[model samples]
Target: MMKEKGLLIVLSGPSGVGKGTVRKELFSQPDITFEYSISMTTRVPREGEVDGVDYFFKSREEFEKLIEQDRLLEYAEFVGNYYGTPVDYVRDTINDGRDVFLEIEVQGARQIRDKFPEGLFIFLAPPSLSELENRLIHRGTESSHVIANRVETAKKELEMMNLYDYVVENDQVKKASERIKAIVVAEHLRRERVEARYKKMLEVK
Candidate 1:
């Protein structure tokens, strides 16, 4: 029997929605089996960062060539630097029967959806707009103006929840992590995923 292909699990949300925090929590769990997809970037590695571990560092020309070749699943430019997921890595990992998890921005998630509609898309939403705004303010890393702009953008992103297969609310970091894990478990057990395995068994019998 052929081995089942693994899932492409995407987790995305608006800025200041604690996506990083929730992802860290989820990955810390021993039971989590998905491999994190390392993104490629055209930027200098920060101190203590390692290539192929932190990010697959690339030159602007090299990265652009990848774009031209359509080797990237999704990519975006921010502050003159390009960051993206490599299509080959994702495809190879899943084909090897190892799930690949992507933690990315809302726009990047949309891009992934376009290319991989069969992948599981989960929208990480804040409990409320006011709560989201408050979390942004508490972070104290951005200017008040920047915070306001992010809140507005988050409102627009929230509307995109309809595009996702599941919505996991960020009520608490632990709770959100638990919910996401549960979703992944359920997705693996979905009928469509298991039907082929069962059918192959019957054929062999």
Candidate 2:
């Protein structure tokens, strides 16, 4: 039997676009190929965050060593802290016939696209800027000033939507989730990805 080729799915969007909520629903469906990548970080563990669950929680020195050794597919410095995606885990998981999903900002997505041109890019866009701003305000979890900053950044991020391979409008939860599921299923049957596998499976020696 031919093994399934793994996919690198990149999810990128501004905050309050409902990417998290929609992705949660899709991952819960269990009808598609998706894996949450555990990112490694040098930041201190936040409240209720397990050592290896929310993040790898590595020491700054260790993270730098990995960067020096070129063991990271991508790494970034945010607010004086370091975070990165380990290359080995991604390579191994893909070789095992499973798809890997990366949840990152637009910058990270761009970097990955530059390296892996064939990777799938999906952007989750809010129904409207007003609705997205409302979500930020209604969230009520962050300070007004912080929310404003996030909204400002979100507006800037929206400009990059044209660079994505797929744009998923997250207006209605059910409809958006269905759209994402269909996108995954369709990509799985992409000629290059499935053609070789089917050929191997049908080959008679």
Candidate 3:
């Protein structure tokens, strides 16, 4: 039997939505088999963030050079920093039959959609716009003005929810993670994903 290519699962949403939180929760599960695709970034690493493990930290010049070479699967500029996925790593890993998960912004997710239409795209949505704003404010990492700007940008990003294959509301971190896992399981069982393998099995007999 031929090795089946792995699934590319993208989790994205508007700014201030709990995408990272939900992704972290999902990976914490013992039975999770997906490989987390480490994204490359030009942003300064936060405290205790290891290079290559948390992100492939690069200089702006180096990141731009990769962009010019088309070596990135998807990339976007956020807060004056470049964040992107490495194309070769993702391709090779998926070809090896290990599902890859990407937690990224909506803009980067859109780029993935254009390049990998068959990939599973999950949109993490807030319970309400007000709730999203509250979450952003509670984070307290950004100034009030920055938070306001993010809220505005989130409004526009929310409109792009139609581009995703599934919408998981981040009302609660654990519940959202559970819903995402269920979606992945369902995607694997999708007829198109498995029919070809079954057909080949019957033909062999």
Candidate 4:
């Protein structure tokens, strides 16, 4: 039997859209074995963020060197912070026939979508701006100014939803997670690509 091909799934969403919760759900059932592609960033790790787990934290100089060496598969600057996807990890995972998941912002998503046109992309969206605001406020992780800015930014992000291959409304965690998982399962069963290859074997001798 031929080895399975790899899938590169790009996860994009606004800041307060509960993308992380849905991602946790997507990985919970163990049906899909995907490596969480670790992103390299110049930004300092947040409180409780672990090295190599939350992100591949690097010094600004080191990140610049990587950029200069063309070692990044996709990289973008957001609000004065640098974020990049290392090519080696992604390349290795894909070669191993394991799907890789990239959780990035809209700009990075656009870059990836353009580079790999066939890559599967899903955008998580809040049910409404009000609900998004409520969730952000309740998180209690940011100050009023940051919260206000996030809300304003989310409006712009939502406007770009059409660019994604799939838009998942992330309101109730359980429902949204199932919807995302359904996409993966359905993709596995899609008949267009693999069917043709299997046809030769199944044909009459």
Best by lDDT: 3
When summed lDDT is taken over every stretch of 10 residues in candidate 3, the lowest stretch is 128-137
Error of 4 at 121 (Å): 0.8
Q: lDDT per prediction? A: 0.89, 0.79, 0.89, 0.80
Which residue pairs show backbone clashes in model 3? none
Residue lDDT tens for model 1, 1-205: 4678899999998778898789889888999999999889998999988999878999999999999999999999888999999999899999998899998888789999999999999999877765666776588767779777777767786688978999998989999999988998998899978998678778888
Model 4 vs. true fold: TM = 0.78
Give the per-residue lDDT of model 3 (tens digit) for 128-192: 76566677658866677877776786777578898999988888999999998899889889898
Q: Each model's TM-score, in the order given?
A: 0.82, 0.77, 0.84, 0.78
Candidate 2 lDDT, tens digit per residue, 53-168? 66799999999999999998888888989878888988888878888877776767777788877778998877766566777658966777877776786767577787799988
What lDDT is reached at residue 172 by model 4?
Answer: 88
The best candidate in terms of TM-score: 3
**Which tens-of-lDDT digit does each residue in 1-205 have in candidate 4?**
3445677888888777787777777777677567789888989789998889878999989999998998988899877889999988887887676789888877888888887787789988877765666777588766778777877767776688867888888878888878877776676677864684477446633
Tell me how many residue pairs clash in candidate 1. Answer: 0
lDDT of 2: 0.79
Winner on lDDT (1 vs 3): 3
